[model samples]
Target: MKKLFNNYINTFKGLSIEVWWLSLITFINRAGTMVIPFLTIYLNESLDFTFKEIGWIMPFWGLGSVVGTWLGGKLTDKIGYYKVMFTSLILTGVFFFLLQYVNTIIGFCTGIFLVMLVADTFRPAMFVALSAYSKPENKTRSVTLIRLAINLGFSAGPAIGGIIITSIGYFALFWIDGITCVLAAILLLQVLHPKKAKVLDTVKVENPVSVYKDKAFWVFFIAMFIFGFTFMQYFSTMPLYYKDARFLTEFEIGLLMGFNGFFIFLFEMPLTKWLENNVNSKIRLVTTGLFLIAISFIVLNFTNWIGILAIGILLMTIGEMIAFPFSNSFAIERGKKGNQGEYMAMYAISFSLANIFCHYFGMHMIDKYGFEFTWNAMTAFAFVGVFILLILLQILKREKAQQNL
Candidate 1:
């Protein structure tokens, strides 16, 4: 056991302070997001908001995230990664704590939006820092490891939030989340402090309108947007469905989200490590994942049994673990060294778009057609995403080959 432990320690010796620090950032931020798994519940039950109201407020959160993505990327490229990351971390913590005072719907929505915006801005800077710190040989593995830390944090946070919410109410969850983020930010300030890189090029950034001219980038973005649109509903609409159906309690919902984190912790490393070099691995894994997501949601409508819901949740978790990392790594691999921040910024936009559309459309669809129809429609959307992603992968492959020639 002593020899094995020594080997484990030695294995990580090749990793830099920057990579380790970024992992800490991811873990801390993910812990804060645990409160989000229950935010819809809190708003509905504690603050007396309707699903439609939540949906309307949802786009503001996405808009905040978009601001984060843009600012983090641009600032990381201009000033430095550590500066942007550290600032965002502190801001995120402050806003999360502010949620405690928000009683009205407008205040609540504004609080959530600001918190997400600040929290999300750290992401592009974090990813760019990780990529900058890693050797080319280990880039993909480094990305996977960071994601592993995030999932591990997610696993712990939801379970902890569940207990806190049950014992002390929703305010306690926000407080703990805020405190953890501050602690993590302090750690970031102390260790893995990244020096500013000398700018070697001044490539003009394409405006949003001009950016759409890149067919490949658009293809990737659209694919991710569709995937996110279907998957993000789990955080909002699906929880309400399960609650209304009496298939889960507040704690149970937290437990279900925790289960996703758990399996990712247990399984994702070996799975990604095995799939890393193989051609089309991203496409295959994500395809399977989308299939599982579609199937799980479809299956949920027929059963009110907690056991069946648990099984469906497990399936969703499996799909998530496969697709999330694969898509991220795929985007990184396709990007140039100097432009990684830009690529990640664009990638982040996909999820924001997903949240906006999923919440906006899913809420309306649920109101008109009910949970069964909404989920079924989302399943179809997931399949369409799968098809789009695969086609894009094929196109990317051909483009690469042509460039090689």
Candidate 2:
């Protein structure tokens, strides 16, 4: 048991202090992500909004993320990750407070859009900073470490948000969320100098290439969109499912969601380390992750058993653990040659685009058809991604062989 504990601890060794600081900042920011996860529930119960209306409002998060990440990417390359990240965090905190007053559908749509625009600008810049802070050899583990912080914060945010919602009301979540974002910005300010090499450096490509022109990345992007669309259902329609089907309270649902983050916190880093050492092909590893997530939804329909909910989350969490780190490594490596911000932004945008479509699609299907059909539709979509990504593995290999020649 001691040896096992030590082995797990070994996974995090040797990373630079700046990388640790970045993870801390991510943890704080992610921990305050209370509003988005519960926004669907709040819209339905408190404001009496229809699922379709809620769907319309939620896509703004994605729309904002798309624009935010793009702007962030450009700003990171031109200015620096430091300024962009710090400003986004502080501005996003202020926006969260403003979002509290937006009760109408249009108000929410605009509010969420504006909030996410500022909030998501941090995503690409954060990753670029991650790439800069980490050594190339330890990059995947470093990515996993950051993800662990994210999941850890994710674990805390919803569980605490649930308590606040149940004890007080949803209004308090905004204060907490906003305060934490500003605090994270302050923490970032404390940790590193503005012009530190890792924080501020942007390499110039001999002749920069357009991220849009990268055919291979576009293929991967499509698959990631499917992955995000399906994965996002956990926070969106899945909560509605728990409320309607399984009859869980807000606190219970938060615990369920928190379980995903907690699971990742405990297991993902060691798991990622093992996979990095053992796996020969990162693409194939991602394909397996995609399948696991697809299968997680099917598990829900497997029985009328309540325990299956836990099982489903477990499967989905495992899939997330497998897919995300290597994909981060792949994107960072690809962006290393030139135009890092664009590549990272494009990568983040795929999920942002998925965010746009997933809420609308999932809620529409659930409202019109049923959860079973909705689950099946998302499953089929992910299976398509699985097949497409396998083809991507072959494409990556061919591209490598040609480059070698």
Query: Best candidate per TM-score, number?
Result: 2
Which pairs clash in model 1? Answer: none
Q: What lDDT score is found at residue 274 in candidate 1?
A: 59
The residue pairs in collision within model 2 are: none
Q: Write down the worst ten-residue block by lDDT for model 1.
A: 196-205
The per-candidate count of clashes, in order, stands at 0, 0
**Which stretches of candidate 1 lie above 4 Å from their native place?**
1-17, 33-58, 97-108, 159-176, 195-213, 240-257, 277-281, 298-311
- Give lDDT tens digits, candidate 1, residues 1-405: 999566445444555556776787788778767787687788889888898887666677778888878777778767767788888888877887888888887887788778877888788877777766777556666777798887778777777888898888898887888888888788887776543332222233353322335677678788788878888888768888878865578788877766776777666665665566564566667777778888878887777666877888788877877788777776665445336666777888888878767776887898898988998898888888888878877887898799899
TM-score of 2: 0.89
Candidate 2 at 237: error in angstroms?
2.8
Candidate 1 has an lDDT of 0.75
